[model samples]
Target: MNVSLNEVEATAKRAARGAGYPWGLAEEVGKATRWLCAHGIDGTNSLAQLLEQGLAASLKNHRPVEMQSAWAGQGVLCPIITGALLSDRSDLLHAGPIRIQKLAVPVFLLPFVASAARAQNIVITHTCDLFRAATDGDRLEAGQDWPSFSDHTQITLGGQLTTPRPHVTRATPDPACWDTLNRFAHRTYAPATEESRLLGAGAGLSDND
Candidate 1:
């Protein structure tokens, strides 16, 4: 189904919630999808892939993100949780750049870096396309020197102290992107039971005159 970009974000948010992400992280995913869509990148497909593959389990179990190791048991780090930790303890970046042994869906990881740039009042950089975000959240600076997210299994990310103002741009996502998210979103709705349906919204009212 073709949907507005706003609807795309809202549905992904609800689906993420139903899929067991905490409300806060779900909210982040929503905004992230919208931002990516505006950039002409399909973050919805990346999010759906993560859910279908049950990647949240890897995230839920891997807390207290550290620099010395890969996620325990799972070979890759969950970006939502890892991103949260990275943002929360951003001071750790002062020591040096950190590396992830393997990261699933690199596109999903960029939003947090953008947010960190805004929150910390500095420029933030990440693995995907080597994009850098400004502190005002007004720009994403990138050059053609970087590779696509699909080409990498792991990456290094860090921050720079510079901040610059640049023109902003956003575009509507393709219809195919909306369809991809709906495939997983359909699984999130609860099946209505007989009793619940009888008492559910507008259940007791009828139009008969």
Candidate 2:
């Protein structure tokens, strides 16, 4: 219910870590989830599903491959890593419009698209009328309409990029999203002992701290 964006981002990060992502990748997932909510996409649900399906653990052999017209991988690809890689590789756009055959959470790729566009000096076009990438990634401007979900996503690069207007009011993730993420994150915590409970975070004025 009406959670803060910071809360959403933090929770997503913790959940990713719980689900076995490295801290760096978990940080990317957190930022991506926050970015998705900023643009009116259901990143919380997307991430929740990604973890629920155990895609993170299943990714031993499902690394992304550059396809004829799309990027594909066995099983489902981690959107956070895929997006990060795509942004870093500025030359991949030369292969024409690229599609991810099965992006577990394509919503997480939007911000990376913007960043990639800036890096490659090109514009990223999607099926929607509202992807607003600010000159600075932190200053992004989200609008009314964002892309809808699908099994696959196609990305086209062209023309000069424009700055999008920032969303006026912040959006909150559904409670179900938080609940699901929390359940996942719970797996990371050790079973609390008496000392762990009473002296949480730092032993609160106790010498043992």
lDDT, candidates in the order shown: 0.58, 0.69
| Residue-wise C-alpha lDDT for candidate 2, range 1-209, written one tens digit per residue | 67678887888899998988888988888887887777666678778877776667766545586666677776667777777887787577787766677665455677787777777765665432224333234444434443433466766666433555454235566788779999878877899887777778666656853
Question: Largest lDDT belongs to which candidate?
Answer: 2
| Residue-pair clashes, model 2 | 0
lDDT of 2: 0.69
The lowest-lDDT stretch of 10 consecutive residues in candidate 2 is: 127-136
Badly placed stretches (over 4 Å) of model 2 are 66-69, 127-152, 159-169, 198-209
RMSD of each: 4.7, 4.5
What are the per-residue Cα lDDT tens digits for candidate 1 across 43-162? 676676666656565565544344564332244556667666666766655655545545656566666666666666666566543443322243554332222233332223444435
Error of 2 at 38 (Å): 1.9
Per-model clash counts, in order, read 0, 0
